[model samples]
Target: MEDFKFTISKFLKRTALVLVFLLAVLFVFAPSFSLAQVNTGIEFGAYTGLAQTDVRIIIAKIIRVFFGVLGIIAVGFTLYGGYMYMTSEGNEKKLETAKAILKNMAIGLAIILSALAIVQFVLNTLLNEYQAGPTGETTPPIGGETVCADCGFLGSVIESHYPGRGAMGIPRNTKIVITFKYDILAGSLIQDSNNNGQFGDTLGGGNNDRPSAAFKIYPTTGGESAAMAPNQFDVFLSVDKRTFIFKPKVLLGSALQDTNYTVKLTDAVKLADGSSAFGAIGAYSWGFTVSTVADLTPPQIESIIPTPSLDKYARNIMVQINFNEPVDPLSASGFFELASGDPTKNFQNINLAIDEGTKPLISGNFKITNQYRTVEFKTADECGHNPCGQTIYCLPGDKQILATVKSASVDSSNKPQAQITANFYDGVVDMAGNSLNGGGELRINGQNKIVLEPGVKTLNQWQAASGKILDDFSWRFLTSAILDTTAPKLTVITPGSLAEKIDVAAPLNMAFDKPMAIGSFKEIVLKTNKDFNINYTYFGTSYDALGQKVILPTQKAVRTTAEIAHGDFWQKSPTAPADTESAIYYPFAPSLLNDIYQNCFYPAVLQNSPRCVVGDISESNKLNDNTPSCFDLQNTNYEGYCSMGEPCPLVPAPHNP
Candidate 1:
């Protein structure tokens, strides 16, 4: 029996050894299997699967290991308990205690088995459904580009995260990934500080020396709705790896309020086909309300046309207070006054009309008689508040108010006949309680009439007169010469009406309204101012050969009645003659004649009876050829009687001799 027991013990020892060996093998291989469970892809589902499986599996595996260790302990305890029980021969209490210990060990083993069974059942029902696919491949979490529709933000692909879209749209601080089809030149991405919807100082050009670039994520007036973004985004060329990324600490509200945001890809500047650079592609402008609110009130004045300073002669008629703005009709009219009688009390109502065509001008025609003089006006705001401290004068400093005293005609008696002048007040107040203290000068016809000496603040009334500021005056200033507006009129020379013939030798002098320029005369124009008619032939009295003067042949010949009957004598001179009234004379011609028979040679013949005697020579030559009496005696016997040496003696000088 002892031998049998010994053999049984050996067999039990071998079985225990074999179980220990198997447990060691399982422990060694279990870590490898667990590592397999940890394998995951860069995907949302993978992250979820790992999150869900890792903890549970690792915990259960740990409990399983604890159970395995406990099981070995239970077996060892059982053998030890039995050995104790055998050694307690005849000791009832000790044997009973050993049996109790053995019983407790068995009970503990049963409880562990039951609990493990319960856990396995729970895991089978809950986690088993999440088992590896039939292909034995675990699916990883899926992640991709996600856009935040609510806040116009985007998010990057977050692997292993469930609900790839951020919880509440994209966070304001997400970095944006601006991916391009082609690589972006790093230097090309320009940061616009002015926010003028452009990228660079030169409007659209950019530096494009580098391969990739990046910038902080921000909203723009133009962009894709579904693009994912990081808090900062990198712009990279199409490459195996990202090129550059920009990171910025984005202020959620302070910096962006009331500011416009815009952005663009510089790569668009370059394309296979020619394309527009920046603005053509369109800039993205997203407006945000900055913390600061703007409140600015336009300039204002009470009265625009103001009073002019008084003088012995009235300076300017119109009392105007040029308002900084178009005054409310009801509130504006009563502020003006004519300060002629009383310094502070006399004020008048002024008419108002906005100058519409080109420039900002307000014009009104006002009446001011000689008795009423100084024009004055005050400007006040609707609330009677004058931005120009209430000293009746407005100053410039944070405030802009202007006043103008437009000029108008005064009574003729009160206006200066020789020099018309007007005055404008500086730092003058208006109805809106504003003043004109700065900018530009008091100009007349575009010229700074009043140079605005350092102390001169108010612009005086603009003075105008018929000749002072007329078009002629303007032309004079421009060309530095006087221009005549009224044309010159002519009046006949004064003389008693005379029927009697006047002497042609008398000089005729005429008068004119104004003195003419000295050098304005020309050679061909004849006038009575200088030379008179005189015959050149009459100047010579004697001939070179004969004691009497001989007539030299002139290209223009004298005419007789017979020549006049042919009707061919008038002709223009080849060269224009100098301005002179000279007469041509024959040797025996009568040089002196009056207006009655001046121009044509026909009238002069009848006026000069002595000159007709020369024609008798023609009769003598034609009739007798020898003796003057012979010709006359034959003429008497044959036909009409001929006077000796007379041409056409009976034919009445051949009708024109």
Candidate 2:
């Protein structure tokens, strides 16, 4: 401890001696350089040294140089102190010594800066007082030379007025005014050699100062810009020749909303002394977007699936979404909210995206397709089937699922593109980087539960139709596929197929186990078993299976229709044999008949469903029961309620649907 204290004391003594030496040097030169020059007027800048026009400038420069040398020394000490601190490790003595060195360096720098600032202030204040007189504070000195950074020895723009850079909501009648660093060559521009009061020079070829133009404005929308008619705007120079202006003879009508414009000071513009306006330097241009009206156009959500339009849905459904415009994909990770319809819970009852339960997520990745306008989310089941190793099928729990899309997922721009609750990651955005409104929803796949009873079951095909793997596009029953192959039953026939003394006037009628489809009866031909020919005209509305009942004329009244009545004989042809045994064949095509369910009519005594076993109608099984009902034409019963043995109940009427 004694040795450490000795070392610190010796270092302090050395630092004190150095400071005293520097102070002595400054004091020695202080007399030669007047310290009280508060009233002395000086104009030369601190840009030069030695024998300059201004004594104050020389002193300021020398002081600055001295301070610069100290700054370098301080920097060196700082670096060394930092190295000592780091290398000291756990040595308290060395670490403390390094810290002290750094502190002293900082304090020295502050003192040097304060002294320099004091000198500059005093000099400037004295100059101002001398130039402006006692109280009229004079302005600061500006650039006197024509020089630029981009182009050597070139002048630049210093000021402007009206329709300036980034100026918005400009009035249509407003004109452009610009101030350059140097006075422009108006003599060459307007060709004032004749000294005429009016300007009619071909040198200023275009109104926008074409060829060697002075100033021009263009539309930033990348198309044909709005233009004023010729002679509508005139360009001229101010009296001092430093300012240029474009004056309009007529009104501009209205400025475009959300449109930008670019203004440029071409390089062709020359200075008053015949030098380049920018000293042969570069052109200067600036642009800004403006609006005559407030920008209120926001991004919109084009569509979403599992939408309200879908009345029912199944498990393993993906969430599909669409936007009216393109949006940032990275910010779309926040488009999420999953909950149940139980009303008591927020997200507990739902398991979306595989096993992603009620736990709220901080991030999500989305796949954008359909021209980058569509968003799709694959469920666990969907992903699993496609080898993505995720399953997202719905499990039995709440009947309804409630999902929502945050606005931040859509609008990822700097400002709110719309008045929405959601922001960049949670909402939507347009290609213009406009954010979408916040309020949005992610709906449930279905409203009610679909009971899965025994036998074959099939899920809807539309939901699985999208995505990379293209899942069979349909779901199947856990067991096997079941189908109904039972053909329709022909229960009863009206006119017997073989009747000896048949009433020919009685139109034919048939009944099926299920109501036979309309327009079933096909062909009816007349034949005789006798050796002579039988040419009886067989005509009677063709035994309509779907029409008004044909009522035969009363026995006493004259038969008006040309139909074969009772006791009618067959008409024999002239060249026919003595007896042609002709039989009336009512050939029926059972294949053309069908039931309401599209099952073709099958002719059998009794056939039960499932196995569709044919059985007898005695006590074993009854085929004439109402289990398979039909329309009774004889009783004029429109409703197909004619069960063979029982009275036809008030069944609904049947049409050819």
Candidate 3:
């Protein structure tokens, strides 16, 4: 009996030791298994349906599995101890050994339970800390089992918002604007009592109805609880109903300088058809930092297209005026006017023109673009072919054209026009409600020294004057019979063709032989043949004072590749085989790029031509074994590469067009 008891005790001790050793091995190699799963893109745990491989989540899962195994071992030992006690068969020594084993099993079970509870508590605390970062701002949860009060799954209802996500140096008094791909239901944004898709409803107190909770803005430091009250802001919809503007009753970030603020749109927002705005993913949110100072500096004219007193100006050219800052689109569209013939006779009240007996000579459409800073006027008449491309519009030949931008606070009857708010004037105000400083001064050749009226230096002074025109701006130019047919051509391309060892964050620089229309460059496309998952983010496009040279700065490249037995894993594997890592510029399409004279970059004759410019971006002192033809990656049958000349054939004879 003594021998039997000793052997059973020895066997149990050995089994326990083996189990502990196995558990330790699993704990030690758990990270390797997790990484392997991540590399293979495998999903596990109850969140198997979610496409998440966050390291913290993986670690938590591993810990859970380890504790689960421990619990199983504890249960197994309890069962084995019960069987040993039941089979003891009235032997004192065997019964004593079974009782000891049962006691040990109970202690082990208690320890495992306690450890699990402690671990679970720690993990929950850690996840909360990770979600609410150092700034106390709760990051939008991408994928998780944790439930949040104001949180919902990610969605793509919003097209764009200003101040953009993670944007810094935002003005405190700036109004927030959100543009959606589809028209929104007005009632979803504000309390529309009449439900006419307009803000005409009034409460019994005679106050404007408050906005709905669909739109929220709050300081991130204080979380959602500190959100601005609905009554503290007013909502206005655009004429198209695709844009909603939120104007706070007071300035934002007033209590602190350089404060971070978050904007959220809940699922309650709906489309014009009454469908959910954020479809599957219920909500959308972003954060931006506001500056301490407000935008109090009034807007000024930056440049004019048909320069003042210029001779032989193209008849087909569009008149463009650029402002120093983004101006209210409403103000620009209503206050700018154009006419033909003498300004003293044909132009009056800065709005009327009598070129053809009360009929305006230049009847055309006004387009406000470049983020509302550029206003363009295209005449009603279309001219024949010009050097740039087909002429879109034309002016009368041998005629003097006059353009005027008014800075009046009131209309011709001296009554205030429609106001954006109680104190915000409607006539030529900036985004922050600062009126345009157009007081009798005209910016000619990018200088403010050209003062038309000596005493009118401010909008207020201009408004006090008796003249119909108060601090208005006017420029005169003569149109000739000759058409500017010269199209702008590419002059220089930085990191010239096939250049190597380029910095990942380097700006793509391109210079034009002549000043190109700044708006036309928006069509240019820059892409790389790296992994499809890896992408580049262009910050913004900037140009020299001449608008001839453009610089496109991009964010630094992200690290996504890792070396494995079969070459680079994430970047050049079988799934993503373009290992050359080259950046290609697809030639601008016809009619997409235009010169100042409205001439298309690629003539209509060459609209079907294939042209691509390639720039190698391989690492220094390294060569890729697989350098396929550029056309193979782009999937286009293009001719040869050309930086500044005619397009040539790059592929074999049959592939050439």
Query: What's the lDDT for all of these models?
Result: 0.26, 0.37, 0.51
What TM-score would each prediction reach against the true structure? Answer: 0.16, 0.21, 0.53
Residue-level lDDT of model 3, residues 323-419, one tens digit each, is 7776665456422235344321222212322224444546665545555556666666777753322446677777767677765354445222224
lDDT of 1 by residue, 216-242 (tens): 223433344422243222121211111
Which should have the higher lDDT, number 1 or number 2? 2
Native-referenced Cα lDDT, model 3: 0.51
Best by TM-score: 3
Best by lDDT: 3
Q: TM-score ranking from best to worst?
A: 3, 2, 1
Candidate 1 stretches with Cα past 4 Å from truth are: 1-80, 89-104, 120-657
Tens digits of per-residue lDDT, candidate 2, 1-657, equal: 456445544654564465467556655655533323221222112112232234445555665686687668668777877898899989998998888877776776666566556555543432221111121112221132111132111111333233544556644434455544456666444433324453322223332331123455656555324433334555544334554445455434344445566666566667667766654445555555545543223444444434442333333333444455434443332222343333212221111332136524321224443323445553322212211111223322223444444443222242433222211122444433344442223222354332211211122221222221221011111111222233444344445434333332344444444322222221122222222221222111211233333221101111111122111223222223312211232323223333322333422212221112123222332222222322211233223222121223332321111
How many residue pairs clash in each candidate at the backbone level?
Answer: 73, 47, 11
Model 3 bad stretches (over 4 Å): 1-161, 179-196, 199-213, 240-243, 265-284, 334-361, 382-391, 408-426, 441-468, 481-483, 493-505, 508-510, 520-591, 603-639, 642-657
**lDDT sort, best first:** 3, 2, 1
Per-residue lDDT for 176 in model 3?
Answer: 80
Regions more than 4 Å wrong, model 2: 1-160, 164-168, 179-183, 187-212, 220-233, 236-244, 248-260, 285-657
